[model samples]
Target: DRYFPSSKLCSSCGSIKKDLKLKDRIYKCSCGLNINRDYNASINLSRYELAI
Candidate 1:
């Protein structure tokens, strides 16, 4: 079971959730960050390219 639910933690705002209901498709953080369920999870495993 390789399930991942990192959406509960917002990378942009670093918001961590204690318990995320399965019925919730939307993620709301106290930092005022809003994102879709899938999108939010993707962000956790996502990274961008940058040059030094």
Candidate 2:
């Protein structure tokens, strides 16, 4: 089971979701950023790899 910490990734800005809620299916952030949960995770992971 590949689990992406959606609650830990910013759904709107693609940043790390520091204070995310499990109940949030759709990311409603003030930054006007919106995206799927998995997409954020993949992007995060990719960025992380590139940094290293």
Candidate 3:
């Protein structure tokens, strides 16, 4: 989905970081999910389901 905020979404809590920048390599969520941005994106992508 083109609207999926993979990089900005927290894998653990499903929270979206609206202020996330490309320079921000670390993905930090208020739910205490601290992980690499790319790694987090991968996790989110893996769980993505396409709606037909």
Candidate 4:
């Protein structure tokens, strides 16, 4: 997942914001979803359900 931009991606709408910076703490999507960056990343990761 090193190459994946999980933080820059909108977990709600699946939209990618390539311009998102590391300093951005809030995750906002055009789909009317606004959440914390860490929370959003966890949500997106949970969706994958990867087997370890």
Candidate with maximal TM-score: 3
TM-score of each: 0.69, 0.54, 0.89, 0.79
How many residue pairs clash (N, CA or C atoms closer than 3 angstroms) in each of the candidate models, in the order given?
0, 4, 0, 0
Candidate 4 lDDT by residue in tens digits, 1-52: 5666677779889999888788989988889989999999888777755732
Error of 3 at 9 (Å): 0.6
lDDT value, candidate 3, whole model: 0.92
Give stretches of model 3 more than 4 Å off: 49-52
Q: How do the residues 1-52 of candidate 2 rate in per-residue lDDT, one tens digit apiece?
A: 2464544666446556656666666665567777665666566677656766
Model 4 scores worst on lDDT over the 10 consecutive residues at: 43-52
Residues 1-52, candidate 3, lDDT per residue (tens digit)? Answer: 7999999999899989999999999998999989999999998888886433
Residue pairs that clash (backbone atoms under 3 angstroms), model 2 = 8-17, 9-17, 10-17, 12-33
State which candidate, 2 or 3, has the greater TM-score. 3
Compared with the true structure, all predictions reach lDDT values of 0.69, 0.61, 0.92, 0.81
TM-score computed on alpha carbons, candidate 2:
0.54
**Collision pairs in model 1:** none
Q: TM-score for model 4?
A: 0.79
Badly placed stretches (over 4 Å) of model 1 are: 1-5, 48-52
The alpha-carbon deviation from the true structure for residue 36 of candidate 1, after best TM-score superposition, in angstroms, is: 0.3
Give the best candidate by lDDT.
Answer: 3
Pairs that collide in candidate 4 are none
Q: Whole-model lDDT for model 4 versus the true structure?
A: 0.81
Candidate 4 stretches with Cα past 4 Å from truth are 50-52
